[model samples]
Target: MRILVIGGSFGGLTVAFSLRQKLGARHEIVLVSKEARFTFIPSLPWVAMGWRRMADISFDLAPVLSRWKVGFVEAAVIRIDPAKKQVHTAVETLDYDYLVIATGHRSANEAVPGLGPFDGPGHSLMSPPEAEEAREAWTAFLDSPGPMVIGCAPGASCIGPAYEFAFEVHHALARRGLRHKVPIVFVTPEPHLGHFGVGGFGKARQFLEGEFEARDIRYRTSAAIASISAEAVQLVDGPSLPSRYSMILPALSGVRAVAESGLGNPKGFIPVDAHYRHKDHPAIYAVGVAVALPPVEETPVPVNFPKTSNMTRQMAAVAAHNLAADILGGAPVTRTLSAECILDMGDRGAHMFADPIRPPRNRSEMSIGRRWLWAKRAYERYCLWRLKRGWAGPASGLLG
Candidate 1:
């Protein structure tokens, strides 16, 4: 059997390594990624804040995948033909018996004009390059302190990072004794604080509100950002705010290749069944933000459902297991979507665990303390070590 994975990020790497482990010496596996290095995305905020260097969070993919006996292709996937079972990259075209679409998301900066690192006034922490750019921008901001805006654009699912960046910026500025001079504002489309695109978790709204209040980080919920300029951000319903520095998390959209393949939805996300198999293409599967997921519930302002790293890992495991079952004789496994996250507030953090993602769950736990900050740092080290060892077991306790 020939299996092709179309990405090399958290979801793609997990699928490739786990599937290779499940069908060792029995099938050919190829992992394709646009970048040569794999970055620990959750730590990008630290990179932006100058707490971490790019090298600390990224490693070469060639060495890691080669150790697992998987072929690595470092090229952008220009197109995907599900009908023909072929993937066309910038360099070559490859055909596969089974295809896993873990292409993740493309930052939809175009959705919000003037909202990006380059060609815009605001910065982002989505990628290593962007984070590095943000670091430079932040350094410049420190030379002259003023009002700052930190928030997520409409349709954005990656909400946790926005919160993390806001707090980290606060901590960094406070350390420099410039936090009071630069008033920080958090603006989100979520109906309330801590909704996180999955409705409100256990006491999350109250907890976040309290934290923001304590820090004097003003926030605007259900805010619709019309656009951003070099000096200010314009809101649809409210008055424009003068901002000397802005960090806006743009919405995530489907990759252009997948969207053009005619296999994805209008938003460019691939629709998958309960087992993570593509709805129409049985041999194709999708995990991570590349897979289409409906929101837990609708709100006044639009909010896309989140696909965290831990949840994506679970989806990848299930997809890999099912693909293995297709070749070998066994029942496929089904895993529920859950989230375990540590929202780092620099010196302190909050750990939240939700089973089944939505509310009314069997287990919904949340705690806040300085230990969680230490735990988050420890998890980062453990994750890098585990990935280096090619361990792809159940991601039950993994923090993201």
Candidate 2:
């Protein structure tokens, strides 16, 4: 048996490792991805702020996969021929008995004019280049500081980075003794702070509100950005916000390859059943941001469900189990996803957890303090060390 996994980030690596451990040498596992390195995307805001470099959070994917005995193909996937059970890449076409689509997301910069860093006046931290560009802009801003805008566009599901950037900016400016000179404002499509696209968890709303107030960061909730210009961020229904620098998280859509191949929805996200198996093709499975997930509830502005790293790991485990079962002869396994993340706040941070990912969960907690900051840093190092050596087991606890 052979399995082909598209993507080399959290989802792909986890699936590969999980399968290698479960199936041993009985089946072949190969991974295809455009990125040569596995970057810790959650730390991108720090990269933009110059606190961490790209190398600090990223490692070459080839070496890691080779160490795990998984075949590695560095190529951009052009399309998938489901009927033939083949995946076409620019380098070559590969066949597979089973396929796992974990091709992350494509930032929909077209959703809002001037929302991209290189293409427009706005800045972003989505990719390595974008984060470096934002860092350059930040360096320039320090010389002549003014009003700063940090927020997310409508339909943005991955919003934690925006919040993290805002808080980090506050700390950065204060450290430079420019906090009073430059006014900062946070805007988001979420109806309220701490909604996190999975509904409110514990006292997150209150905790974030308190933090914002103490830090003197003004915010606009349920706000939609119409466009971004050199000097301001115009809202769809409200007044424009004057800004010298801005970082906005745009809406995310599935990659063009998946959409063109007809393997996913119109937006490119694959539809999957409980076991992360494709509804139409049992041999095809998907996890991570590549999977289509509905919003938890309706809000004034659209906000899709967040596919956090922790949730993606859970999906990978379940998908690996089911795929192995099909080949080895066993019943399928299914499990609910749980999320836990520590948000870095410059000097302090917040630790939040949600069992089952949505409301009415059995266990949920939110805590704020400086210890979480240390814990986050420690966990990041731990993750890099573990994944570098091809250990993807669930030993990292809730931090994973």
Candidate 3:
């Protein structure tokens, strides 16, 4: 059997790498990706703040794929024809017996005008180049400090970064003795912090509320920002939020590549069963942000769907095991996803972990923290180090 996995980020690579070790040379596995490199994206904020450079977060993908004896194709997937079981690319069409889509999220930049390039985009840290842009923006902001906002818009799945940036900015400015000169505000669609991109983490509501107050960081939760200009963000509900410059994390939707493939749902995300198989097509599976997550619990606002790296890996593991099972003729195993992460505050941070996501019965949320900031740093280094070396299993070092 031939297995083809698309997208080369954490989820896709996890699927490919796991299959390589488990299946050996029994089946052909091919990975299709446009870029030649894999970036440790969670570290992009450090790059943006000039704490790390772009090169440090990125490593060549060709070497790892070759080392594992997996086929690598450097081409953008233009379309996925599930009916034909083939992928259309800019270069050539690749046929597959099984397909795993890990295309992540298609950043909805234009969902808000001026966010991507209202005339010109101010800055972003979603990708490597965006991180560098943010670095330059931070430099200019430091030179002329002013009231600033780090906004997370409605429908935004990756909401943690905005809070991280806001907190880090506060710490950065304080180190320079210019914190009083700069007003740092946190704007988010979640009603509370630690809501993370996943509903609220345990005690995150109380913990973040206290932190924001103590840190003197102005916060506006449940905000649905409509648009942004060079000077301010126009809110959907009321008046424009004023600022000298804004770094807003716009909402995330599925990538157009998957959406146009006719395999995606109305939200451009694929629907997968508990085993990670596509609902209508069992031969296909999906992981990461490209798979739609139902709301954990309904709120007055829109659904708060969580998509963390830990959850993505669990989904990939199930998909890989099932794919291997089909080739080996055995029962497939399914696994439930949990949440884990270390949020950096620069000066100090927190470490939190949870299980079963939406746990059953009376079990409460699991969490613990007390300036385990050093632990967060160690976690980040270990994750990047393991993935680059393909030593990702057993550790499963999730750095969401």
Candidate 4:
């Protein structure tokens, strides 16, 4: 069978690697990506903070895929025709017996007025290039004390990074003996912290609220960032927040080509069924942020998205199993992926929330501690080591 995978980020690379290992040389596998390297996105913050260099996190894709004997192509997918079971790239049309779309999320920086490309006061850490730019800005801040503002625009998803950056900055400043000189502020559209794009996990909201108070980090919850200028961030119906430099997590939408092909939902994200088969086409399966997973709850304003890297991997694994099932004539595996994520809050991280995969009835369980933070760190190291050895790490606990 000819299996073609699109996008080379977490979902794409992970799925390809796993499928190759599972199926061996019996079936042909192909991977299409715009870039020649795979980035471990979770390490981007460390890269931005100078804890690790870019090369430390980036791995050459061609060689790795070659070692696995999977066909690799560096081309941007321009369109997909489910009827034809083919993906049209900028170079040529590639046919697929099974298609997996894992193009990842697109940062909709333009969603807010003048918010990206580092054109002015606006900056982001969503990509490798942008992370470098933000790093430069951070270095400048370190050399000279200034007011720092980090936040998310209205309706933005992936709120965890904003909190992480804010806390990390504060910790870095304190370590540099400039904590008193630098003023840190955090802004987000979520009603409160721990909401974490899933509506405040357990007592997470209260914990985050108190954490900032103790850290002397000013924050505004339920705030919608409207426009960002060189020295100021304008919030809709809220007081303008001042800053010398700013980094905000923009809302993520579907990829340009997927959106252009009219294959995605209103949010520009594709929709998939329980088996991860595209609702519009059975041959096409989508994993990762490319597929839209409904938000857990309705908020005062939209501030969450269901698509995350871990969730994306789960989605891709499910897609791979189901696709294999179809080819081998077996039952498709369907399992709910539990929401197990660790959020770092500076000195000590907190482990919050445990839900059965797909959460049962507005229910989420959680626990917090310094031990959990250590465990999270252990997990990161374990994952890096495993990846280096060509292995995907074990599953993370929902509340570890």
| lDDT of candidates 1 onward, in order | 0.89, 0.91, 0.78, 0.78
- Which tens-of-lDDT digit does each residue in 1-400 have in candidate 2? 8899999998999999988887898888999999899999888898999999999999999988888889999999999999999999988999999999999999999999999797789999888899999999999999999998999999999999999999999999999899998888999999999998999788988888989999999999999999999999999989999999989999999999998999888888999999999999989999999999989999999998999888898898889888888988799878878889999988998999999787789988998899999999998898899889998768222222
TM-score of 2: 0.97
Q: Which sequence of candidate numbers ranks them by lDDT, best first? A: 2, 1, 3, 4
lDDT of 4 by residue, 342-391 (tens): 76666777765546434443557567677876887786676555555555
Per-residue CA lDDT of candidate 3, range 77-170, in tens?
Answer: 9999999999999889999999999998876787678775233454566778778888888898899998887867677778777778887888
Best model number under lDDT: 2
Model 1, position 284: C-alpha lDDT score: 96
Clashing pairs in 3: 195-200
Clashes of each: 0, 0, 1, 5
Q: Is candidate 2 or candidate 4 better by lDDT?
A: 2
Off by over 4 Å in 3: 117-122, 359-371, 395-400
Report the error of model 2 at residue 157, Å. 0.5
Distance from true location, Cα of 284 in model 1, Å: 0.4
Off-target runs (Cα >4 Å) in candidate 4 are 357-374, 392-400
RMSD of each: 2.0, 1.8, 2.7, 2.8
What would the per-residue lDDT of candidate 1 be over residues 206-316, giving only the tens digit for each residue? Answer: 999999999999999999899999899888889898898889998988999999988889989999998999999999989998999988888888999999889889998
